[model samples]
Target: MTSAVTGRRRLMGAGLGAVAAALAGCSGRSGPVPRLRLATGPQGGPYNAFGRALARAVAESGGRLEVVPVATAASVDNLRRLDEGSVDLALSMADAAEDAALGREPFARRAPVTALARVYVNYTHLLVPAAGPARSVADLAGRPLAAGAAGSGVQVLAGRLLGAAGLTGGPAPADERQLGLAESAAALRAGTVDAVFWSGGVPTPALTDLARELPLRFLPLDGYAGALRERYGPVYTAVTLPAGAYGLTGPVGTIGVGNYLLAREDVAVSPAGELLRVLFDRRRDLLREVTAGVRLEPRFAISTGAVPLHPGAAAYYRSVYG
Candidate 1:
């Protein structure tokens, strides 16, 4: 009888031990796990789509990544947020990154940020009404133009291009409106603005939508493309918009800059490395989610000129491409 009792006790003890082990596992005593917060651009833009795709990829990779969509002025503001440690990851333009890193132009001092990867090129789109008198950058001298938003990279580059063409601001200063791309598009369609400058990827949804509803023309920047490239070095490159890319009658020659994924200098190396690996490893899946992801290739990932690479990101690049 004692032997029978001992056998039953042992079975109960074994059951209890198994339950205790399961409870311990549920308690999550496993080491510290890092979570990432990725910052992306305004609604209905390439950055937003890309951010969502990346967040999904990270989640599937067993990493905790939260995507934060910010209604920002785009690259310039993104870089500022990165420097201030307001975000872990951000999308930025090479032009804005170069300027911020070097403490030139809009940035009063050097910013604390580094690039993870150069994802794609953004075209400098000078969209005007189909019947507008301004056919080229030079003709926009005294016209009412919306040069994107105040703190946006688009504004920075638009201002530069305008200044280069001797068209810095409207003849009557009050006539110029520095607004966000979405707002500028709306204002243009309402006939409240004569023209607007948008530096973005091809098939930008907003621009495409506008093209469908209204007759539009993209003013070719060919004349000044060489000069801009020479002045800006690798930060600016000659890009061409294929015919019908934006429903244009013909291909438009323009200057462009690469868009990169950036991060704060202090972000954890491990998580950053994991984030980059997920981005590149699942590039095809991301592209299926958004066409902009097609540009997120290994070849262009480290194409930034002088912008320091995040050590974690650099490590991943060297591992794969080295």
Candidate 2:
């Protein structure tokens, strides 16, 4: 009986030890997840809206992500941050992405950044005071124009468009006032600026408000659209703003480019995949959250040409759309 009792105690001890070991292993191992930092544009830009939606989706998907609002100059700044590893993810324009990847335009050297997906298209809007003499892109010569903030994607594109129209340098050269959207609107109202160049999604609050309060004219870029595409390649395409998009008097012809999400090459594939999955899974929710994100679709997401897609993102795309 004594021997039997001793054996039973030994058996109990071994079983308890095994259970504890199993529990320890379970505790030691954790699901593969990574914390990510997403870089967005200025406080009130379309990029901010997109970033917020992406953050909410990642949170819902049980991934650790923190969207960091960055006051950048748009696409150019986004690429620079990705190249230096300062940001794990960023929002960029497709044209700028191409330029950075190919070491063209502002990029002195090729940047090592890849795309997660293209998000939406941004239209180039040329807004003028209703009573201003600048009836078209050509009328702006020798007038003051808000070309967007310095070092911004808007400024780069605005400069190119102005140059192509032969309105950059002349006897009465158009002066570019480097200002944010809000400031630009104010300048136009005060008659300090004759016209403003903006590249963004429709229903822009500042421009919309300006149109509602005062008479505004949106100059058509009809003749120069083909020329811009020829010079800038396929990244630029002709886009039209419908009559009611911003309470405009009529439809306006413009040139536009796509927006894309970017990530560094070093980020893990799993987390990237998870990020893309969350974004697409809750696509409707995101669209309701922000009007700009409403246009995000699987077809547009895979249409990037400037920067290569992240492997994880590509996998997610293939899984859903394939």
Candidate 3:
């Protein structure tokens, strides 16, 4: 029999055991089994999908470390949880991670967070009805739209996008709704909303499924990426969503944000580094869940912009290049 199966028995144990795992891993080998809580995003999102795969990889590696994936609002929520020490690991967008680390807007205080790696790029998507009058962000004025769930990174970016387009606090600001990916798609199909803003992996599963049922018209952000980059830091970049996605005739230009696997500064070094080892080795497992083009490159993993890499993860990268 294979000994690679995963377990959550530790989570169901006594509070004493929980106290013992205050830090996920030990400095050296041999200690209480490392069990970590990973804060993933909503169910119909890439963070949750990739996070689950990582958990399985950890279990299947037959490693001493165990990870439990906790579902919540994306990026912002994940960072907050990591800050409070509620979860040992988190998945977040680079822009949001930058905000949290710098005590910027949406984050009143600096979060004690560091990156494990830059896992993937989140393609910002703005979808409208195929036959709707809203062809651009400006056209969405006074139109009802879903801007991702509250406390989510999508919402923050949505606000930023709208603000950049001069749509916020104006005479005709967008009628914004806070809904998760699945709910937003359903709203769009049902004609309850005119547009939906989602920042996720390319070929996002929920959006793809929505395209099948309801024809979608993706609006191009055009120059917003450059505009945003000037206001923000290097977190925002121009990226193209190539042709054939959602049956589009040609490519659509959009903003791209790197997604980072994050952890608290005090998280132990051993399990943190071990998690990356299992992650890169089991990269194929994530492909089963994330978008087709989503990849984990060692050099890109260390390119988390302003967010500093966790010492453990930095050591792992050093070991890799050395």
Reference-based lDDT, each prediction:
0.73, 0.74, 0.82
lDDT of 1 by residue, 112-161 (tens): 87788888778888888998887887776666788877777788788778
Lowest lDDT sum, 10 consecutive residues, model 1, at 19-28
Off by over 4 Å in 3: 1-28
Query: Per-prediction RMSD in angstroms?
Result: 14.7, 14.3, 9.2
- Candidate 1: list runs displaced more than 4 Å: 1-30, 64-71, 169-175, 287-294
- C-alpha TM-scores of all predictions: 0.84, 0.86, 0.90
User: Which digits, one per residue and each the tens of the lDDT, describe model 3 over residues 43-100?
Assistant: 8577888889899888898778899999998889999998889999999998999898
- The residue pairs in collision within model 3 are none
Model 2 RMSD vs true structure: 14.3
Best by lDDT: 3
Which ten-residue region of model 2 has the weakest summed lDDT?
Answer: 19-28
Regions of model 2 farther than 4 Å from truth: 1-33, 64-67, 287-294
- Give the Cα-based TM-score of candidate 3 against the true structure: 0.90
